[model samples]
Target: MAVHPLSALLSGLVLAASAAHANGDAPAGGEPAAAAQVAGLWCGDGLLHEFSLRLNQDGEQVEGELLRKGRVRSIEGRIDGQVLRTQSTKVGALVLEKQGEELRVTGGDGPIALARGTSFRRSPGATCAS
Candidate 1:
């Protein structure tokens, strides 16, 4: 069977994260890079449960290709102030949080919450706590 490119990339990212941990290298994001890119591609699988989302953010706008068991779907939303209001075309809307370098999608089809170390914020409208 052929490995999906996205899967391979996700796998590589996981390996790198693990290696960095073993080396005691403090991750740059320290929380998650995808949280703030605001205009880049992101993909991750929850440590527990079978959930993964590949999100892309553009300024205050966010949308991504959600993957479920080799199936790809779409999710879209926007960052409103400190809160993230989003909805999936297939699923629905969800509330998200931004803390440090991590942005967590709260109460949704993705996970109880899905978080990652992100490089930056979605846009200038939202700011992290001091």
Candidate 2:
């Protein structure tokens, strides 16, 4: 049997996070990093565009891949309090906050530019295909 590349990557990430936690290097906040609600696959649709975010959160640090307008880009950021802030050369900066079952893009500049209030839903079974 063969393991998917993404699965392998995520597994490695989980291991690293566990090791860090065991070493007393948890996130700055009082809450456990494993409690992060943004660590999952999310998707959103707009009037003219669709995007998907495959995020992995390890403590305050976040690493993920973003799919927007059929283009894919790797993104890295940190969780500041309740917001996840990510930056990419192609997309500038993106600030996301979890609201109930949605992850809303509170502020940011993407190539296609989503509105400030645009929200994404957790879609773990969804693909990045646009």
Candidate 3:
């Protein structure tokens, strides 16, 4: 069964949120606060599943892997203000923005099932485990 990259990507969103709460990073709202830096682990819980993403930032360049169901996809991009724009040779391109404590999907290329505005939380101390 071939899994769509977008589907796998969105799945990680749910897990990121779960990890955040477990780490005691969540506020009363049950969501963790967003970090100023893009370099770290992020998780998101989608309507259907969970997923994780790990990012490393150096200056303006950002590189990371999005993980779901033991599969990993490499992505690279740049940051401008609160927005992170990333591209993957296998998964295509995606754009995310930090809004308060959530990293929301703002845009993307190609036909994607992951909706724009789908959000993920910063998973501090969370590792991108397969």
Candidate 4:
């Protein structure tokens, strides 16, 4: 089987996740905290379904990639404050709302309720770390 770019990208992102996780829930040095955690991959679970997202922040804008099962392409989004809005290339847009240790992305036909518990892991060569 041929290796997919997103697969490697996903793996790399997981590594980033682990490093970025701040168990303390707060940043030291009195540095300003970001509204959204834009430093790695995130996985959202729902019964048999799952979603993965990676946010690469450059300055004030965030470049993101969304991966869904059965689909090779990924959705894209931007972040500002505690909200993340990604525009689907095919249909609708998803909104990711981050509140403390919890996060939720809403869209699709069903209810837009998602739970947060840091499903994303750190990859092999990650640059984002605490």
Among all candidates shown, the one with the greatest lDDT: 2
Q: What are the per-model C-alpha RMSD values against the true structure? A: 18.4, 14.9, 19.5, 19.8
lDDT, candidates in the order shown:
0.52, 0.74, 0.72, 0.53
TM-score of each: 0.43, 0.62, 0.63, 0.47
lDDT of 3 by residue, 15-129 (tens): 8877877775675487544434777878865741367778899877899987777788888988765778887565567788877667788888754325576877777565532
Comparing 2 and 4 by TM-score, which wins?
Answer: 2
Better of 1 and 3 by TM-score: 3
Q: Give the residue spans of candidate 1 off by over 4 A.
A: 1-49, 108-130
How does residue 33 of candidate 3 score in lDDT? 48
Cα distance off (Å), candidate 4, residue 90: 0.7
**TM-score of predicted structure 4:** 0.47
Tens digit of per-residue lDDT, candidate 4, span 1-130: 8889999999897665555545422345434456576556555444313655666766546666655654544555666556666655554555666655444654332232233323333333432122
Candidate 2: the clashing residue pairs are: none
Summarize candidate 2's per-residue lDDT along 8-125 as a digit string, tens digits. Answer: 9999998988787676567645345443458888887464237788899887889998777767888898886567878756657788887766778888776534557787778757
Rank order by lDDT, top first? 2, 3, 4, 1
For candidate 4, the 10 contiguous residues with the lowest summed lDDT are 109-118
